[model samples]
Target: MKRQYLFSAFLAREKCLLYYQGTIRYVVVTADSGERIQLGLKHFQPYFSALGLRGRFRLTLTETGAFDSLEQIN
Candidate 1:
């Protein structure tokens, strides 16, 4: 089974990296409520070029509450 969540965030400009579970290319963002989110480039490749640093978007999180996809909101 899997779960999905929706939230708004702003892409962070500061370079940050995570090697969690043997994965890299993670992008860090700040949630609307001030929570920091780490999104992986592997999952966000399609939207990568479209979303600039500090860009705002509505995130669709896959299982484990890790963002799977996104739609630009601003």
Candidate 2:
């Protein structure tokens, strides 16, 4: 049988911190409560274009409780 997972959503603000690790670029997300989540270049670029790294966003998690994706809420 196939297994299923649960997903969670939370509100977080876009926090852009551009940096390079050797050659790969990354962006990190910071919540108001002081939690941080780092995103990869592939993931960050697309959303950054749409959201522009400001305002509030709805953060979604994967079935395993890891950061999956985000969308602008405000």
RMSD of every candidate to native, in Å, equals: 5.9, 7.4
- Give the clashing pairs for model 1: none
lDDT of 2 by residue, 29-66 (tens): 66655577655545444444433444465566676767
Clashes of 1: 0
Q: Model 1: per-residue lDDT, tens digit, 1-74?
A: 34333455444323222332344577566666677777765554444443324445677766676645676666
Poorest lDDT segment (10 consecutive residues) of candidate 1: 12-21
TM-scores for candidates 1 onward, in order: 0.46, 0.46
Worst 10 residues of 2 by lDDT: 2-11
| lDDT (Cα, 0-100) at 30 in candidate 2 | 65
In model 2, the Cα lDDT at residue 50 comes to: 34
| Candidate 2 deviant stretches above 4 angstroms | 1-24, 49-52
